[model samples]
Target chain A: MFDFFIHVASIACLYGVLALSLNLQAGFTGLVNFGLIALFGCGTYGAALASGMGWHPLLGLPAGIAMAALLGLFYARLGRKLSSDYWGIATLSIAEIIRISITNEQALTGGAQGISGLPLLFAGLKPYDGMARLALYVVVLALVWLFCQRLVKSAFGLSMKLMREEPQLARSLGYDLDRIRRVVMLVSSAIAAFAGFLYAHYLTFVGPDQLVSPETFLIWSMVIIGGVANNRGVIAGAFLMQFAMAYVPFIKDALELPTDFVAAARLIIVGGGLLAFLLWRPKGLFPEKVGGSNGR
Target chain B: MIEAKDIRAGYGDGADILTGISLSADRREIVTILGPNGCGKSTLLKTIAGYVRPRAGSITFGGTDVTAVPIHEKVRHHKVGYVPQTDNVFGTLTVAENILLGARQLAKTEKEKRFAALMDQYPALAGKKTRKASALSGGERQILSLARALIAGPEILLLDEPSAGLSPLMMHEVFDAIGAIRDSEGMCILMVEQNAFEALGIADRAYVLSLGQVAMTAKASDLLEDPAMRKLYLGGEVHAE
Candidate 1:
């Protein structure tokens, strides 16, 4: 049971990082970035490719971040020509194109066979055996959390909120909307890629299948159902949804229910939870506060 | 000094709103553009503020041709300040932060000094400095808009319907603030307003616009007393003395 709890907690932390990164663009900037999975996939692939080349795992982390940021810049350039539903469609198409490219690039990415035996982030430490490894993972998660918190409170963050609420107003006030948008996209993509690197290193393996459309949909649902604008709500939603998905089988086993039926039940619960969240608390657990005097 | 010569402009390729319009403003003068709705009053202000590019003609500020300048460059070079009619204040920013954003291009020490000076000049903003702009009353927001504009020490202040959608008391306060600025700061105040009588009453010179063209230009007091102007532009019934 203790091991189960640890596994669940670790997975939740991972998803929480992804959710926070998504919230930076979608929630704060009002960008409909359906291609977020592309950045995550890039991170996973970049890290895997770099580590597979026998480079230090730490080197792969920055490589993944840089590659994802470049992709984000590409997305931002594309986003400028579209907005709202049109932007959503454009991004979805871009994501599909990226996934197809990855799948087809057989030689470079090991094709659909995927990459395996990637080095662990802290190879010197034993897996799940010592407090050091657990502590390191926790520290990584904490650093990501701190970075996100700082970003949301910064001047750039406030500017992003302004752009989201009213682009015209933001422009009239002298903010260069296009430039800010690009910067935000790059930063969010880098963070997502960083999370991806962590994921690849932790698992020591990755594939095109891991970067599928379903993974993208799952992250989006986590962000939207959790409340796009609320960071805490996003983290809560990530953990709650991931844990529920992972733990339902245990419940089914205890009850002696069929495994297939239990899996279907989990999907239904998740779908129902998403529907309920949208209908009831559309703003999530912590709605953004409105109206206050300017900062000092 | 600021001047617009033969300035012809409109939205997109639409008909020119300010056709062959010519206007000038010097320091220490209050020039009000009085017109009915959709008469290009705001367009003229926007054109001068560099928000709109005139299709033909030139805008010279301080004897420099600034017709092709971007809005921010014009703001920096010509020291032009604009207070838009709507969403002038950032809803999420505190009033103080909104003001600071106005002075963002300034040095940190200079921005702090300007902030202090403006707060002192407009005492009403002192207590509400830390309040978010979205939470302010309409009048307070207008005051914040003015405060933000003035913090930059702009040579020319372009105000677009500063009193629009405000209560009578708020309108009076805005005009009073404008009057005080004119009396004390020697800032060039060029404004577009729908309130003809009230605008002309306080303005040094006023131009009446109709169909995006200038119909009349004269001393504010003269325009107010012109019976034909009163009948055609102002309401048919004049305010009793």
Candidate 2:
């Protein structure tokens, strides 16, 4: 049971990072990035390819982040022409294109077999190694949460909030809307890619299937339920989601349901919770606070 | 000085709302544009502010042809301050933050100095500096917008419909604040106003636009007394007191 909970806690930390990254783009900046999983896949593929070539995990991690950030910048430039509604579809389509290409390019990406035996981030441990690894993961998560907190309170963050609420107002006050949007995309993508690096190394494997729509939707649910622009809320949301995901299997066993039925039930439960939040508490558990003097 | 020469502009593919309109305002002068609804008065101000690009004409500010400069560049490089008729102050930002948005490029000491100076000029804002801009009354909001723009120390200020929706006494207070800004800063101001009598009262010069064309251009006092101008554009109401 200790092992099971440590595994769940480690996964929760990784998802918390993803949630915080997405919140920067979607919640603070009002960008709809439906293709976030595509960027995550890029990170996974980048780190896996590097590790497969015998590179250290630290070097591979940066490679993944850089690859994802380039894609994010490209999409941000394209965003200038596309409205929000269309941008969501465009991003979703791009994710599928990347996924399909990875599936077809068997030689380069190991094709459908996917990459295996990825270099472990924390390999070679002693007694209670699982708990130690989980503790380290929590530390990393705390650092990321602190970084996001500082960013959200800075002047750049204020400009981001302004861009979300009133682009015209932001532009009139000397903020270049295109530049701000592009920078934000790059930053968020870098953070998401880092989360992917951790996931690839922790699991010691990475497959294109992991970069599916459900993964992206799960992160969205966390952001929506925790609080849109609040970092603390996002972390809380991530842990709550992990708890739900773990407990559903226990329910399946207790009720003697089929394994396939549990998968469908998990989706229904997550979707229903999201709908309930939208209807009852659109602002999530913690709503965004106004910035600047009034914000204090 | 700021000048717009024969500017033709419209939204998207629509017909030109401003067809070859030319106007100018010099330093320390309050130039008012008075026109009926749909006469393109606001469009003229927008064109000068670089929010609306002129198709065939040019806008020169302080001897530079900034016809193609983006709105952000106009505010940062050209020192242009624009206050839209509505939604001028950010409701989510504090009153001080709204003012500081334009003053970001200044040094901390300079920014604080300007903030202090503005508080001195507008005593009402001094007390409400920590309050959200949304909490302000309509009249106070107009003053907040002016304070925000002036905090940037702009060389040219463009105002659209400053007295759109206000009681008569509030309107008087807003115009008084505008006149004070002009006298204190010695900056060029071009305003589009529907309150012709109140506008012309403080304006150094006034232009009456009819159907996207300049119908009359003269000293504010001259336009006030001109019977034909009053009959056509000034609602033929009470003369300037």
Candidate 3:
């Protein structure tokens, strides 16, 4: 039971990092970055390509972040002419393009077979034992959480929120919209890339399938259902969603339900929850910043 | 000092809203543009602020031709401070943050100093420093907008219909604030206002615009006391001088 709990906790931490990164762009900036999966995929591919060539896994982490940032710059440049639903479409198209490229780039990404035998994060530490792995993962989670908390409270974060709420007002106040959007996109993508590195190393495997649209949809749902603008809410939503996915087998087996029915039931629960949240609380559980209330 | 010579500007290739509109404001002077609705008063202010480019002629400030300077560049150089009519303050940002953002181009130390000075000048804003701009009343928002623009320490302040949609009491307060700013800072102030009588009373000089053209220009007191001017433009009624 302890081992199971630790494994669940570790996965939750990974997803929490992913959701937090997405929140930076979507929640604060009101940028519908559907191409988030592209950044995540870039990180995974960057790490896999670097480590597959026998480089240090730690070195691969920064490489992943750099690759993701570059992609974010590209997105920022393209996203300038688009807004509202058009922006969403543009980003979604970009994500699809990234996925297709990964699938076609057999030499670089190993195509469908994916990459394996990737180096562990800390070679000196034993990760086969569940508790040790869980501890290390928690450490990573804590670091990311602290960094995100500080980032959302900084001046840049305030600028992003202002831009999100009213771009015209932001412009009048001397905010260069293009510059702010690009920087925010780069930073958010880099954070997401870092989370990707963690996932790659955690699984000891990386694949193109992991960077597809379904994963993007899952992350968006997690952010929306958890709370759009709340950092802590994203973490909670990610954990809840991951826990549901992970524990479905136990629920199914204990209830003597068929595998297909269990899969359908899980989807129904997640879908219903997401719909209810959106219909009832469009701003999510924690609304954006309120007057005089420092978001804690 | 600022000058707009025969400036023609509009939303697009349509009838020029500000047709051959020439005006000037000297340092330590209040120049008010008074006109009826649909006149080009606000457009004139926007053109001067670099928010709208004049289709013809030049806008010279401090003896430099800044007719083509972008809005952000103009703001960075402190050449112009614009207080838009509505929704000028960023609703999501705190009043303090909004003021800080206005002075973003200044040095960090200078920005801090200006922020402190503004807080001292506008005591009503002090208690609301940490409050979101959206939570402020309309009058407070207007004051915050003016404060934000002033924090940039602009050489020329462009105010667009500051008295629009305000209670009479609020209008008095806003005009009082403007008077204090002009008296203390000695900055060049250009304002577009629908409240013709009140604007002329506060202005050092007043320009009357009709159909995007300057109809008359004179001292504010003379315009306010002119029976013919009052009968023709001031709501078709002549008050005893």
Candidate 4:
């Protein structure tokens, strides 16, 4: 039970990072990034490639983030001419292209079989392996949470919200839209890639299947359910989602439901929950807080 | 001081809305641009504000050609302030934040100093400094917008239809605030308005635009007495204030 609980907590922390990252773009900056999975895949493949070459996971982390950043910049440049609606389609297509590339590139990515047995995060701390690993994840989560809080409260955060709410006004106020969009893409993608690096190391595996659209949808749901712009709400949303994702299968088993019905039921529940929330609480659990002069 | 000489401009691939229009405003003076609907009054102001680049001619402010300067660059480098006819205030932001948004480049001490002075000038806004700008009345929103533009210490202020969508009484109050700004700041003020009589009442000079062309340009007082001006633009009757 202790090991299982730790495992669940670790996974929750990992998803929490992803939720926070997506929230920074979709919630705070009002950017619709449908290609989060591509960035996540970049990080996973980066870590996998590095570890497969016998490099430490710590050394592999930056490699993953850099790859995600480069991809994000490319997307930003491409998205310049497209409207928001088209941008969404463009990002989704990009994610699909990245997944297809990974699937076909057998020589470089080990093909569909994937690379496995990557180095553990705390292989040095052998006796208390699970606890130490969980501790590391928790520490990273805390640092990210604190950093997000500080960011959203600062002048930079104000500029981001302004850009989201009033792009023309933000531009008139001297905020270069191109530069702001690029920076946001870079920052959020790097953060998501960081989470992916940890996930790949923890699972000791990397495969194209892990970069599916459903995984990205799960993160978006967490952000939407928690509250778009509120980081604390995002964390709470992640836990709620982690709980549902974990126990829905258990409930299905207890009911003796057919294996095919499991995926269908989970989708129905999540979709229905999102619809209900949109109708009743469009802003999510915590609405974006607009600060007054007191903040200055 | 600012000058626009024969600027011809329009939206992309659209016919020229501001066709060979020229105007100027000097320090501590108010220049009013008046026209009928679709006569390009707002477009002329937009051209001057850097929203529309002129296809010909040039705009000079502070003795340097600023025709090619972008809106944000004009604001940051040339201290050019602009308030759109509508959506002037940031609805989600508080009144104080709206005013302080332009003061981002100022030192903390200077920002506080300007905030105090602006509050003193517009007492009504000072009372609702902590409230969201959307909660303010239409007249109050106009005042808040003015305070915001003024707080930036702009050398040139461009206003588009400052009295649009306001009651006569509120309009009077808004014009009073504009007069106060001119008296206090001594900045070059250029305004585009449909409120002909009231605008001419405060303007030092007035230009009447007809079909994107300047039909009349003279001292405001001189145009107010001109019978043709009253007949063509001012509705042939001045409402009793």
Candidate 5:
């Protein structure tokens, strides 16, 4: 029971990083990125390739971040001409294209069977490796939370919110809208990629199935339920929803429900959660403080 | 001072909305642009403001050729202030944030000083410093927008319908405030307006457009007294029904 809870905590912390990344782009920058999983995939594939190449395990970090940043720049370029809704569709399509490409690249990515048996990140810790991994994720989540909080409170953050709410006004005020989008996409993608690196290492596997549209929507549910623009709200959201998801199997077992119920629960959690919050709490669990930057 | 010569502009391969429009406004005066809907009043203002580049003319601000400069460059380098007709204030920003959005380049002391002075100038916004702009009334939003432009201490102010969608009393008050800016600050204010009588009342000069062409240009007083002009553009079914 103790080990199971630790495993769940580690996964939850991993998701907290992803939720923070998505909220920073979609909530504050009005990016509406629907291909978050693809950015995460960049990290996973980076690590998997590094492991397969017999490179140093730590080398994967920068490799993964670089690929994600390049994809981020591509996404930002798409945004310069496309409106938010169209840009969302474009991102979703790009993610699908990437997944398909990886699936067909049998020699490079081991086809759909995937690459596994990745070395653990903290082999040096030995007997306490699991706990060490969880601790590292927790520390990472804290750092990301602090970083996001600091970002949103700064003048640049104000410019981001301005771009989100009133983009034309932001441009009129001398902000390079395209440049802001690029920076936000780059940072958010790098963060999402970091989560992917952790996920790949901890699970010892990389597969296209993990980079699906639904996984991105799951993160959206977390952001919607936690808070849209609030950094702490997203982290809290990630943990709560991740635990809810992690416990679904237990619910199935306790209720003696069919195995398919586990799959159905994902749809319910994402779609129903989004609908409920958008209807009742449009701003999410913790709406940004009423007085704008002054409240912070 | 701002001047445009024979400006022709449109958007995204569309028909030229502004054709051969020439106008100028100098310091200590308010120049009003008036026309019927689809006659390109807003387009003309936008062209001069650099939101739309003129295809066949030149724009000079304080003796610099700024025709190709974008709106942001014109604003940051040339000290231009613009207020759109509607949805002008940043709803999510606090009143103070909205006012200070463009003054990021100002010195800290100067920014704060101007902010305090603006608050005193617009007492309706003074009490709502920390309040989000979304909560303000329409008239207050208009005033807040004006205050935002004024805080920059602009050399040229471009206003698109300062009294748009306001009660007659509020309209009069907005025009009075604009007129005060010209009289006191000697700022060259060029505005596009639909409320012909009120706009002309405060403006020193007026340019009337018809079908993207300059239909007339005259002193505001002369245009106001021209009965045929009021009937054709401001009164009767042409404007009312």
Candidate 6:
């Protein structure tokens, strides 16, 4: 049970980082990034490819970040020509393309089987590796939270909210929409890639299955159920959802239900939670602090 | 000073909305463009403000050819301020934050000073500096938009239908505020307005556009007194008071 809690906490921390990344782009910037998982896959693939080449998994860090940055830039370039809804579709298509390529590229990515046998992030610690990894995730999540908090509170953040809510108003005020999109995408993508890198090591595997559309929806649900633009709420939502997911099987067994019910339970939890929040509390657990003169 | 010569522009691949429009306004002057609906009034203001690149003409502002400068560049480096007809204020932000967004590029001290000055100039907004822009009434919102543009200390101001959707009383207040901007800041003001009488009352000159062309250009006072102007635009109702 102790081990299960650690696992849940670790996974929750990792997804929290992802939720924060999405919050910056989707929540604050009003960018609908349906390809957010593609950005994460960049890091996983980078690490897998590096390990496949007999290099240290650590080397994949920079490579993955760079790949995510380039992808983000491309996404921003695409956004210049497309509005938000169309851009969302475009991103989803690109992510699907990336997933298909991973599935079909047998030689490079081990095809559908994926690349396994990657070492744990703290494997050197043997019996203590789980705790160490969890500790590292906690520290990382804290740092990311602080960094994002600082970013959202800055003048740039105000402009981001402005652009999100009133794009023409922001443009008329001399904000370069393309530049803002690029900056936001680059930063969010890099953060997502880092989370992916951590996740790949945590699982010791890189697979196309990990880059599914449902994963993106999962994070979106967390953002929505927690709070759209509120980081603390998003992270809390991450933990709440993660814990609920990690224990669905336990609930199924304890209830003497068929194993198939676990999957249905998860769907109900995520979808029902999202629907509940959207209907009753659209702003989520901790609503974004806006308009207070003190917001500055 | 700002000028557009023989400007032709339209929305993406459409026929030119503005055809052969020539206009200019100097500092300390308000030049309002009055026209019937779909006469390309807003498009003309957009073109001069760099939102639309002129298809076949030149634009110069403050002695520089700004024909190709984008809207953001015009507002940032060239000290241009623009207020659109609708959705002018950032609805989710405080009045002070909305104003400060316009002054983001300024030095901190200068930004604060300009904000303070705007607060002084618009006391109605001063009490609600921390209030969200969405809470403002229509007249207050128009005033807030003006305050936002003014906070930037722009030299070239472009307004699209400044009096749209306002009560008659609020319309006059907005126009008066605009006239005050010209009187106090010495900025060149170019406005597109449906309220011809109220606009010409404060404007130094006026241009009446008809089907993408300037039908007439005259001194504001002259246009106000011209019987032809009344018959064409003002419903030919009461004589210009």
Per-residue lDDT tens digits for candidate 6, residues A264-291, read 9999998898899999999999888776
CAPRI tier of model 4: medium
lDDT of each: 0.80, 0.86, 0.82, 0.85, 0.89, 0.90
**Pairs with backbone N, CA or C atoms under 3 Å apart (clashes), candidate 6:** none
Which whole-number lDDT from 0 to 100 does residue A241 have in model 4? 79
Which CAPRI level is candidate 1?
Answer: acceptable
**Separate DockQ for every predicted complex:** 0.27, 0.60, 0.34, 0.50, 0.59, 0.74
lDDT of 2 by residue, A1-296 (tens): 77898899999998999999999898888898888998888778888889788887678778898899899998898898788889888988888888888887877688777999987655677666777778888988998888888877888887888888877777788888888889889988988898888888888788888888878889999999998998888889999988888889899999999999878877986798689889999889988776673221
TM-score of candidate 4 relative to the true fold: 0.91
Residue range B1-241, candidate 6, lDDT tens digits: 8878899999888999998989889999999999899999988888888778889999999789999998999999999999988999887778887788788778999999999999999999999988889999888898998888888899988998888899999898898899999999999999999888888889999999999999999999988887878889755466545
**Model 5: per-residue Cα lDDT over B1-241, one tens digit each:** 7989999999988988888889999999999999899999999988898788898999999999999998888888899998988889888778998899868889999999999998888888999988989999888888899898888899899999989899988888788889989988899999999998889989999999999999999999988777778788767344432
lDDT of 2: 0.86
lDDT of 5 at A119: 87
Worst lDDT run of 10 residues, candidate 3 chain A, spans: A287-296
User: Comparing to the true complex, what docking class would candidate 5 get?
Assistant: medium
Please give me the DockQ of candidate 3 compared with the native complex: 0.34
Model 1: what TM-score? 0.84
Error of 2 at B127 (Å): 2.2
Which scores greater on TM-score, model 4 or model 5?
5
- What is the TM-score of each predicted model, taking all chains together? 0.84, 0.92, 0.83, 0.91, 0.95, 0.96
- Highest TM-score, which number? 6
Q: Where does candidate 4 clash, by residue pair?
A: none
Candidate with top DockQ is: 6
lDDT of 4 by residue, A1-296 (tens): 67777888889998999888888888888788888889988888889999888887677789999999999998789766777778878988999988888888888898888888888778787768889988988888888888877777778778878778877676666666677789888888888899899999899899999988878888888888888898988888888878776677778889998887778877866687677778999888977776643321
